[model samples]
Target: MGRKRRLITDSFPKVKRRKGGPGPGKEDGAPEPGLRGEEPCEEILAAHLDETHLEILRQFDLNRHFGPCTGITRLQRWERAEQLGLEPPQEVLKVLWAHPEDPQYQCSLWHLYPI
Candidate 1:
């Protein structure tokens, strides 16, 4: 007789929040980083990301992957931006990293993807 195989989900716990970083949930009104206690002005947002950086963000956002198992390694630059009195760049990169299926991303892969 053949043995029956168990499903992966049956053997493992569902991962919710990322292991190291906090992510939004299935519901709306998720808290914005650094905005829970205060409102961030355009000037503050602009300081960290200028027109050029904004362009980068636009491209990055177009390529993200959503849901669980995603990771973002930006603490170092984020702290630097903060210490210099700047905010971290918006979650555009996260959005792009999540959904690589977008065609726009494929065109940009050569320059953006690591070797």
Candidate 2:
């Protein structure tokens, strides 16, 4: 028990803190990945979705089966909910289909569902 101790600061590498912000990644405005789903585009959803439909999606987002609604498309979430006997609004599926392949609506919840 007579060994010299190494200072905590000397034991770790030093990182210069950026004055503006942490990084260009999250500072630009995006939710912490895996913490929650990317919020659905309300502007787009508003055009097709009513209050009822919006609420349905919100509830599903808060209460999901596999993971945060982040990596999966809204359509996929609706299907999973149906499988679990949770009747999410059908408009979600319809809106997803009607829209022309938005980058937002295309994703995977860490898995390419097997066919």
Candidate 3:
């Protein structure tokens, strides 16, 4: 007769390790890197804006949208403009949104409107 085989069914507990830097409880109390404790500047650049342009900017701020026009894709920019009731020229809007870091988009703006 063949010998009977023994079955193993025991499981080991999992061990958890710390991830990344440190947890909240382990904080050293120094202000985290790149963080400042002062309020940001609130200066408005409305000196050159007419009532209509100012209203548009106010709507943009009321919607909590900031940053370059090109923060979103071209399609998204148009959709957002429509949603916000803004009708600025498409070329002007494109120039405003083009990423400053991208030389190609920046140069394209000059081509669109000669100085």
Candidate of highest lDDT: 2
**Residue pairs clashing, model 2:** none
- Lowest lDDT sum, 10 consecutive residues, model 3, at 39-48
What are the per-model C-alpha RMSD values against the true structure?
A: 19.7, 12.0, 13.6
How many clashes in each structure? 9, 0, 2
lDDT of 2 by residue, 1-115 (tens): 9998889899799878779675744665566753446555665467465555445545555665534566567677777777888777666676567554754333433335553
The all-Cα superposition gives candidate 3 an RMSD in Å to the true structure of: 13.6
On TM-score, the stronger of 2 and 3 is: 2
lDDT of 1: 0.46
Provide the overall lDDT of each model, using Cα atoms, as 2-decimal numbers.
Answer: 0.46, 0.60, 0.45
Question: What is candidate 1's lDDT per residue for 1-115, written digit by digit as tens?
Answer: 5988889789888766656564555345556567644656776676564545445644443443321111332333333444766444556445445445654432332334554
User: By TM-score, who's the top model here?
Assistant: 2
The C-alpha TM-scores of every prediction are 0.23, 0.35, 0.20
lDDT of 3 by residue, 4-110 (tens): 76556335555565777566556756565435543333323333333344344334433434333433433345456667776634543544354445444333222
For candidate 2, the per-residue lDDT at 30 reads: 62
> Residue 101 in candidate 1 has what lDDT?
61
